[model samples]
Target: MASEKTDKSRLRRDLLRTRAALPEGDVPVNGHALARHALQLPELTGAHTVAAYVSVGREPSTREVLEGLRERGVRVLLPVLLPDDDLDWAAYEGRDHLVPAGRGLLEPDGPRLGPEAVLAADAVLLPGLAVDRRGLRLGRGGGSYDRVLERLTRAGSRAALVVLLYDGEVLAQVPAEPHDRAVHAVVTPSGTTRFPAL
Candidate 1:
Protein backbone atom coordinates (compact mmCIF):
# COMPACT_ATOMS: atom_id res chain seq x y z
CA MET A 1 0.00 0.00 0.00
CA ALA A 2 2.77 2.41 0.89
CA SER A 3 4.65 1.54 -2.28
CA GLU A 4 1.55 2.23 -4.34
CA LYS A 5 1.20 5.64 -2.77
CA THR A 6 4.87 6.40 -3.40
CA ASP A 7 4.61 5.28 -7.01
CA LYS A 8 1.52 7.38 -7.55
CA SER A 9 3.19 10.47 -6.10
CA ARG A 10 6.27 9.92 -8.28
CA LEU A 11 4.18 9.46 -11.43
CA ARG A 12 2.19 12.60 -10.64
CA ARG A 13 5.36 14.63 -10.30
CA ASP A 14 6.69 13.34 -13.61
CA LEU A 15 3.39 14.03 -15.40
CA LEU A 16 3.12 17.52 -14.01
CA ARG A 17 6.67 18.23 -15.06
CA THR A 18 5.89 17.16 -18.60
CA ARG A 19 2.74 19.27 -18.66
CA ALA A 20 4.75 22.26 -17.53
CA ALA A 21 7.07 21.77 -20.44
CA LEU A 22 4.37 21.95 -23.11
CA PRO A 23 4.77 24.72 -25.66
CA GLU A 24 2.71 27.79 -24.82
CA GLY A 25 0.65 27.55 -28.02
CA ASP A 26 -0.20 23.89 -27.59
CA VAL A 27 -2.56 24.42 -24.67
CA PRO A 28 -5.26 26.24 -26.60
CA VAL A 29 -4.79 24.07 -29.65
CA ASN A 30 -5.28 20.97 -27.54
CA GLY A 31 -8.24 22.60 -25.83
CA HIS A 32 -9.89 23.27 -29.16
CA ALA A 33 -9.36 19.71 -30.29
CA LEU A 34 -10.53 18.36 -26.95
CA ALA A 35 -13.69 20.42 -27.14
CA ARG A 36 -14.43 19.16 -30.62
CA HIS A 37 -13.78 15.55 -29.68
CA ALA A 38 -15.49 15.61 -26.29
CA LEU A 39 -18.65 17.19 -27.66
CA GLN A 40 -19.21 14.14 -29.82
CA LEU A 41 -19.16 11.64 -26.97
CA PRO A 42 -22.49 9.83 -26.61
CA GLU A 43 -22.37 10.42 -22.89
CA LEU A 44 -22.30 14.23 -23.23
CA THR A 45 -24.55 14.28 -26.30
CA GLY A 46 -27.23 12.30 -24.48
CA ALA A 47 -26.73 14.00 -21.17
CA HIS A 48 -29.19 16.51 -19.77
CA THR A 49 -26.73 17.63 -17.13
CA VAL A 50 -22.95 17.34 -16.94
CA ALA A 51 -20.82 17.80 -13.87
CA ALA A 52 -17.45 19.26 -14.95
CA TYR A 53 -14.64 21.55 -13.94
CA VAL A 54 -12.69 24.51 -15.28
CA SER A 55 -9.06 23.79 -15.99
CA VAL A 56 -6.40 25.84 -14.26
CA GLY A 57 -2.77 26.65 -15.06
CA ARG A 58 -1.10 23.97 -17.19
CA GLU A 59 -4.01 21.53 -17.00
CA PRO A 60 -5.77 20.66 -20.24
CA SER A 61 -8.21 23.49 -20.86
CA THR A 62 -11.91 22.81 -20.31
CA ARG A 63 -13.13 26.34 -21.13
CA GLU A 64 -14.08 25.64 -24.71
CA VAL A 65 -15.76 22.36 -23.82
CA LEU A 66 -17.86 23.99 -21.11
CA GLU A 67 -19.08 26.68 -23.49
CA GLY A 68 -19.84 24.14 -26.18
CA LEU A 69 -21.88 22.03 -23.80
CA ARG A 70 -23.88 25.07 -22.67
CA GLU A 71 -24.52 26.07 -26.28
CA ARG A 72 -25.95 22.62 -26.87
CA GLY A 73 -28.46 23.19 -24.04
CA VAL A 74 -26.79 20.92 -21.53
CA ARG A 75 -26.87 22.19 -17.97
CA VAL A 76 -23.28 22.39 -16.68
CA LEU A 77 -22.26 22.09 -13.07
CA LEU A 78 -18.86 23.40 -11.89
CA PRO A 79 -17.27 22.51 -8.59
CA VAL A 80 -16.59 24.86 -5.70
CA LEU A 81 -14.09 23.67 -3.12
CA LEU A 82 -15.49 23.54 0.37
CA PRO A 83 -13.50 24.19 3.54
CA ASP A 84 -13.13 20.49 4.13
CA ASP A 85 -11.80 19.81 0.60
CA ASP A 86 -15.11 18.35 -0.59
CA LEU A 87 -16.71 19.99 -3.61
CA ASP A 88 -19.89 21.99 -3.76
CA TRP A 89 -21.33 22.60 -7.22
CA ALA A 90 -22.84 25.58 -9.04
CA ALA A 91 -24.28 26.31 -12.44
CA TYR A 92 -21.74 27.28 -15.12
CA GLU A 93 -23.24 30.51 -16.37
CA GLY A 94 -20.29 31.37 -18.62
CA ARG A 95 -16.67 32.43 -18.44
CA ASP A 96 -17.75 35.83 -17.22
CA HIS A 97 -19.36 34.34 -14.16
CA LEU A 98 -16.23 32.65 -12.88
CA VAL A 99 -14.33 34.27 -10.04
CA PRO A 100 -10.87 33.53 -8.73
CA ALA A 101 -10.87 30.99 -5.92
CA GLY A 102 -8.43 29.22 -3.66
CA ARG A 103 -5.63 27.03 -5.02
CA GLY A 104 -5.45 28.98 -8.29
CA LEU A 105 -8.86 27.73 -9.40
CA LEU A 106 -11.62 29.66 -11.10
CA GLU A 107 -15.03 28.77 -9.70
CA PRO A 108 -18.54 29.74 -10.63
CA ASP A 109 -19.64 32.76 -8.65
CA GLY A 110 -23.20 31.60 -8.30
CA PRO A 111 -25.24 30.03 -5.55
CA ARG A 112 -23.84 26.84 -4.10
CA LEU A 113 -25.96 23.78 -4.85
CA GLY A 114 -24.19 21.57 -2.36
CA PRO A 115 -22.12 18.49 -3.27
CA GLU A 116 -25.08 16.17 -3.64
CA ALA A 117 -26.19 18.09 -6.72
CA VAL A 118 -23.78 15.96 -8.74
CA LEU A 119 -26.17 13.04 -8.40
CA ALA A 120 -28.45 14.70 -10.96
CA ALA A 121 -25.83 14.65 -13.68
CA ASP A 122 -26.03 12.14 -16.50
CA ALA A 123 -22.25 12.32 -16.96
CA VAL A 124 -19.52 13.41 -14.59
CA LEU A 125 -16.29 14.80 -16.09
CA LEU A 126 -13.37 14.10 -13.82
CA PRO A 127 -10.06 15.99 -13.80
CA GLY A 128 -7.02 13.75 -13.63
CA LEU A 129 -3.28 13.75 -14.30
CA ALA A 130 -3.53 10.35 -15.98
CA VAL A 131 -5.74 7.33 -16.63
CA ASP A 132 -4.59 3.77 -17.28
CA ARG A 133 -5.63 1.12 -19.83
CA ARG A 134 -7.63 -0.53 -17.07
CA GLY A 135 -9.50 2.79 -16.67
CA LEU A 136 -8.24 3.58 -13.19
CA ARG A 137 -7.63 7.33 -12.79
CA LEU A 138 -4.72 9.02 -11.02
CA GLY A 139 -6.04 12.22 -9.53
CA ARG A 140 -4.18 15.11 -7.84
CA GLY A 141 -4.08 13.36 -4.45
CA GLY A 142 -6.49 15.86 -2.92
CA GLY A 143 -9.15 13.18 -2.31
CA SER A 144 -11.94 15.57 -3.34
CA TYR A 145 -13.07 13.62 -6.38
CA ASP A 146 -12.55 10.42 -4.45
CA ARG A 147 -15.27 11.67 -2.11
CA VAL A 148 -17.42 12.49 -5.11
CA LEU A 149 -17.03 8.99 -6.50
CA GLU A 150 -17.80 7.44 -3.14
CA ARG A 151 -20.92 9.57 -2.86
CA LEU A 152 -21.97 8.52 -6.32
CA THR A 153 -21.55 4.85 -5.46
CA ARG A 154 -23.35 5.21 -2.15
CA ALA A 155 -26.28 6.75 -4.03
CA GLY A 156 -26.10 4.19 -6.84
CA SER A 157 -25.59 6.86 -9.48
CA ARG A 158 -25.58 5.58 -13.03
CA ALA A 159 -23.86 8.74 -14.22
CA ALA A 160 -21.10 7.95 -16.68
CA LEU A 161 -17.71 8.84 -15.24
CA VAL A 162 -15.40 10.46 -17.77
CA VAL A 163 -11.96 12.09 -17.74
CA LEU A 164 -10.42 14.68 -20.03
CA LEU A 165 -6.71 14.65 -20.78
CA TYR A 166 -4.01 15.35 -23.31
CA ASP A 167 -3.07 12.56 -25.72
CA GLY A 168 -0.10 11.27 -23.77
CA GLU A 169 -1.88 11.20 -20.44
CA VAL A 170 -3.44 7.88 -21.33
CA LEU A 171 -1.06 5.10 -20.26
CA ALA A 172 -0.94 1.31 -20.15
CA GLN A 173 -1.12 1.25 -16.36
CA VAL A 174 -1.19 3.45 -13.25
CA PRO A 175 -0.88 2.59 -9.56
CA ALA A 176 -4.24 2.01 -7.92
CA GLU A 177 -5.59 1.49 -4.42
CA PRO A 178 -8.58 -0.66 -3.54
CA HIS A 179 -10.93 2.31 -3.25
CA ASP A 180 -10.11 3.55 -6.74
CA ARG A 181 -12.82 3.28 -9.41
CA ALA A 182 -12.50 2.84 -13.14
CA VAL A 183 -13.89 5.52 -15.42
CA HIS A 184 -16.24 4.75 -18.30
CA ALA A 185 -14.19 6.68 -20.85
CA VAL A 186 -11.31 9.09 -21.34
CA VAL A 187 -11.51 11.85 -23.95
CA THR A 188 -8.17 13.17 -25.06
CA PRO A 189 -7.32 15.87 -27.58
CA SER A 190 -6.66 13.19 -30.13
CA GLY A 191 -9.72 10.95 -29.54
CA THR A 192 -11.79 9.05 -27.01
CA THR A 193 -11.14 5.70 -25.38
CA ARG A 194 -14.13 3.86 -23.92
CA PHE A 195 -14.01 1.20 -21.24
CA PRO A 196 -16.59 -1.42 -20.53
CA ALA A 197 -18.96 -0.48 -17.76
CA LEU A 198 -17.78 -1.37 -14.24
Candidate 2:
Protein backbone atom coordinates (compact mmCIF):
# COMPACT_ATOMS: atom_id res chain seq x y z
CA MET A 1 0.00 0.00 0.00
CA ALA A 2 2.73 2.41 0.98
CA SER A 3 4.71 1.55 -2.14
CA GLU A 4 1.81 2.48 -4.37
CA LYS A 5 1.51 5.83 -2.67
CA THR A 6 5.21 6.47 -3.06
CA ASP A 7 5.11 5.48 -6.68
CA LYS A 8 2.23 7.85 -7.33
CA SER A 9 4.07 10.64 -5.58
CA ARG A 10 7.24 10.06 -7.59
CA LEU A 11 5.34 9.88 -10.86
CA ARG A 12 3.38 13.02 -10.08
CA ARG A 13 6.56 14.94 -9.35
CA ASP A 14 8.25 13.77 -12.55
CA LEU A 15 5.24 14.40 -14.76
CA LEU A 16 4.67 17.85 -13.32
CA ARG A 17 8.33 18.68 -13.83
CA THR A 18 8.15 17.63 -17.45
CA ARG A 19 5.03 19.71 -17.95
CA ALA A 20 6.73 22.69 -16.37
CA ALA A 21 9.63 22.37 -18.78
CA LEU A 22 7.40 22.52 -21.89
CA PRO A 23 8.49 25.29 -24.20
CA GLU A 24 6.40 28.42 -23.68
CA GLY A 25 5.82 28.79 -27.39
CA ASP A 26 4.51 25.26 -27.69
CA VAL A 27 1.83 25.62 -25.03
CA PRO A 28 -0.77 27.33 -27.22
CA VAL A 29 -0.04 25.07 -30.16
CA ASN A 30 -0.65 22.07 -27.94
CA GLY A 31 -3.72 23.76 -26.53
CA HIS A 32 -5.10 24.32 -30.00
CA ALA A 33 -4.50 20.71 -30.95
CA LEU A 34 -5.88 19.44 -27.68
CA ALA A 35 -9.04 21.47 -28.20
CA ARG A 36 -9.41 20.29 -31.78
CA HIS A 37 -9.08 16.64 -30.80
CA ALA A 38 -11.22 17.00 -27.69
CA LEU A 39 -14.04 18.74 -29.56
CA GLN A 40 -14.20 15.78 -31.89
CA LEU A 41 -15.03 13.40 -29.02
CA PRO A 42 -18.50 12.00 -29.71
CA GLU A 43 -19.37 12.45 -26.07
CA LEU A 44 -18.81 16.21 -26.20
CA THR A 45 -20.40 16.58 -29.60
CA GLY A 46 -23.68 15.16 -28.39
CA ALA A 47 -23.51 16.46 -24.86
CA HIS A 48 -26.04 19.01 -23.66
CA THR A 49 -23.80 19.95 -20.77
CA VAL A 50 -20.17 19.27 -19.90
CA ALA A 51 -18.48 19.70 -16.54
CA ALA A 52 -14.93 20.95 -17.10
CA TYR A 53 -12.19 23.01 -15.53
CA VAL A 54 -9.93 25.85 -16.50
CA SER A 55 -6.30 24.88 -16.93
CA VAL A 56 -3.56 26.58 -14.96
CA GLY A 57 0.21 26.64 -14.96
CA ARG A 58 1.75 24.28 -17.48
CA GLU A 59 -1.28 22.04 -17.69
CA PRO A 60 -2.79 21.43 -21.12
CA SER A 61 -5.01 24.39 -21.92
CA THR A 62 -8.80 24.02 -21.98
CA ARG A 63 -9.74 27.51 -23.14
CA GLU A 64 -10.39 26.53 -26.72
CA VAL A 65 -12.38 23.46 -25.74
CA LEU A 66 -14.62 25.48 -23.45
CA GLU A 67 -15.20 28.05 -26.16
CA GLY A 68 -15.79 25.44 -28.81
CA LEU A 69 -18.34 23.63 -26.65
CA ARG A 70 -20.11 26.91 -25.95
CA GLU A 71 -20.17 27.77 -29.64
CA ARG A 72 -21.76 24.38 -30.26
CA GLY A 73 -24.62 25.35 -27.91
CA VAL A 74 -23.44 23.06 -25.14
CA ARG A 75 -23.73 24.45 -21.66
CA VAL A 76 -20.32 24.48 -19.97
CA LEU A 77 -19.80 24.19 -16.23
CA LEU A 78 -16.51 25.28 -14.68
CA PRO A 79 -15.38 24.31 -11.22
CA VAL A 80 -15.10 26.76 -8.35
CA LEU A 81 -12.83 25.65 -5.54
CA LEU A 82 -14.53 25.54 -2.18
CA PRO A 83 -12.83 26.04 1.16
CA ASP A 84 -12.78 22.31 1.83
CA ASP A 85 -11.17 21.49 -1.55
CA ASP A 86 -14.42 20.17 -2.98
CA LEU A 87 -15.59 21.88 -6.14
CA ASP A 88 -18.64 24.01 -6.64
CA TRP A 89 -19.72 24.66 -10.22
CA ALA A 90 -20.81 27.70 -12.22
CA ALA A 91 -21.89 28.25 -15.77
CA TYR A 92 -19.14 29.29 -18.16
CA GLU A 93 -20.47 32.56 -19.46
CA GLY A 94 -17.47 33.35 -21.62
CA ARG A 95 -13.74 34.03 -21.39
CA ASP A 96 -14.52 37.44 -19.93
CA HIS A 97 -16.53 35.80 -17.17
CA LEU A 98 -13.51 34.04 -15.67
CA VAL A 99 -12.26 35.73 -12.55
CA PRO A 100 -8.86 35.32 -10.97
CA ALA A 101 -9.18 33.08 -7.95
CA GLY A 102 -7.00 31.53 -5.30
CA ARG A 103 -4.22 29.09 -6.23
CA GLY A 104 -3.80 31.12 -9.40
CA LEU A 105 -6.93 29.53 -10.80
CA LEU A 106 -9.53 31.19 -13.02
CA GLU A 107 -13.11 30.56 -12.04
CA PRO A 108 -16.40 31.61 -13.51
CA ASP A 109 -17.95 34.72 -12.06
CA GLY A 110 -21.48 33.41 -12.39
CA PRO A 111 -23.73 32.41 -9.54
CA ARG A 112 -22.83 29.25 -7.64
CA LEU A 113 -24.77 26.18 -8.75
CA GLY A 114 -23.80 23.81 -5.94
CA PRO A 115 -21.58 20.74 -6.35
CA GLU A 116 -24.41 18.52 -7.48
CA ALA A 117 -24.72 20.52 -10.67
CA VAL A 118 -22.22 18.20 -12.30
CA LEU A 119 -24.84 15.49 -12.22
CA ALA A 120 -26.64 17.22 -15.04
CA ALA A 121 -23.68 17.00 -17.31
CA ASP A 122 -23.57 14.46 -20.10
CA ALA A 123 -19.78 14.42 -19.88
CA VAL A 124 -17.05 15.52 -17.49
CA LEU A 125 -13.57 16.66 -18.44
CA LEU A 126 -11.09 15.95 -15.66
CA PRO A 127 -7.71 17.45 -15.03
CA GLY A 128 -5.05 14.85 -14.29
CA LEU A 129 -1.29 14.44 -14.16
CA ALA A 130 -1.41 11.16 -16.05
CA VAL A 131 -3.52 8.15 -16.95
CA ASP A 132 -2.36 4.56 -17.36
CA ARG A 133 -3.09 2.28 -20.30
CA ARG A 134 -5.93 0.66 -18.39
CA GLY A 135 -7.47 4.11 -17.68
CA LEU A 136 -6.61 4.68 -14.01
CA ARG A 137 -6.17 8.41 -13.60
CA LEU A 138 -3.50 9.99 -11.42
CA GLY A 139 -4.94 13.18 -10.06
CA ARG A 140 -3.09 16.03 -8.33
CA GLY A 141 -3.73 14.38 -4.89
CA GLY A 142 -6.14 17.08 -3.77
CA GLY A 143 -9.09 14.67 -3.64
CA SER A 144 -11.52 17.24 -5.06
CA TYR A 145 -12.26 15.29 -8.22
CA ASP A 146 -12.33 12.15 -6.12
CA ARG A 147 -15.30 13.64 -4.33
CA VAL A 148 -16.85 14.56 -7.66
CA LEU A 149 -16.43 11.01 -8.94
CA GLU A 150 -17.86 9.64 -5.71
CA ARG A 151 -20.90 11.87 -6.08
CA LEU A 152 -21.30 10.76 -9.66
CA THR A 153 -21.09 7.11 -8.67
CA ARG A 154 -23.58 7.49 -5.81
CA ALA A 155 -25.98 9.16 -8.21
CA GLY A 156 -25.41 6.47 -10.87
CA SER A 157 -24.25 9.03 -13.38
CA ARG A 158 -23.71 7.88 -16.94
CA ALA A 159 -21.66 10.97 -17.68
CA ALA A 160 -18.61 10.06 -19.73
CA LEU A 161 -15.41 10.74 -17.79
CA VAL A 162 -12.65 12.21 -19.88
CA VAL A 163 -9.17 13.63 -19.34
CA LEU A 164 -7.08 16.08 -21.34
CA LEU A 165 -3.33 15.68 -21.56
CA TYR A 166 -0.23 16.17 -23.62
CA ASP A 167 0.86 13.39 -26.00
CA GLY A 168 3.29 11.75 -23.56
CA GLU A 169 1.14 11.79 -20.44
CA VAL A 170 -0.36 8.41 -21.27
CA LEU A 171 1.61 5.59 -19.70
CA ALA A 172 1.74 1.79 -19.54
CA GLN A 173 1.00 1.88 -15.81
CA VAL A 174 0.37 4.28 -12.95
CA PRO A 175 -0.03 3.48 -9.27
CA ALA A 176 -3.65 3.37 -8.21
CA GLU A 177 -5.62 3.06 -4.99
CA PRO A 178 -8.83 1.12 -4.59
CA HIS A 179 -10.84 4.35 -4.57
CA ASP A 180 -9.34 5.51 -7.85
CA ARG A 181 -11.77 5.67 -10.77
CA ALA A 182 -10.85 4.90 -14.35
CA VAL A 183 -11.60 7.46 -17.02
CA HIS A 184 -13.36 6.38 -20.22
CA ALA A 185 -10.95 8.17 -22.51
CA VAL A 186 -8.09 10.65 -22.74
CA VAL A 187 -7.73 13.32 -25.40
CA THR A 188 -4.17 14.41 -26.01
CA PRO A 189 -2.73 17.02 -28.33
CA SER A 190 -1.97 14.32 -30.84
CA GLY A 191 -5.21 12.30 -30.66
CA THR A 192 -7.64 10.50 -28.41
CA THR A 193 -7.24 7.10 -26.72
CA ARG A 194 -10.27 5.20 -25.52
CA PHE A 195 -10.18 2.49 -22.86
CA PRO A 196 -12.64 -0.20 -23.83
CA ALA A 197 -12.94 -1.73 -20.38
CA LEU A 198 -14.29 1.42 -18.80
TM-score of each: 0.99, 0.98
Which residue pairs in candidate 2 collide? none
Model 1 error, position 145 (Å): 0.2
**What RMSD, rounded to one decimal, does every model reach?**
0.7, 0.8
- Candidate with best lDDT: 1
TM-score of 1: 0.99
Across residues 1-198, which tens digit of lDDT does each residue of candidate 1 receive? 999999999999999999999997899999999989999999999999999999988899998999999999999999999999999999999999999999999999999999999999999999999999999999999999999999999999999999999999999999999999999999999899998755
Give the whole-model CA lDDT for all candidates, comma-separated: 0.96, 0.95
Shift in Å, residue 73, candidate 2: 1.0
**Backbone steric clashes in candidate 1, count:** 0
Encode model 2's per-residue lDDT on 124-152: one tens digit a residue.
99999999999999999999999999999
Candidate 2 has an lDDT of 0.95
Residue 66 CA error for candidate 2 (Å)?
0.4
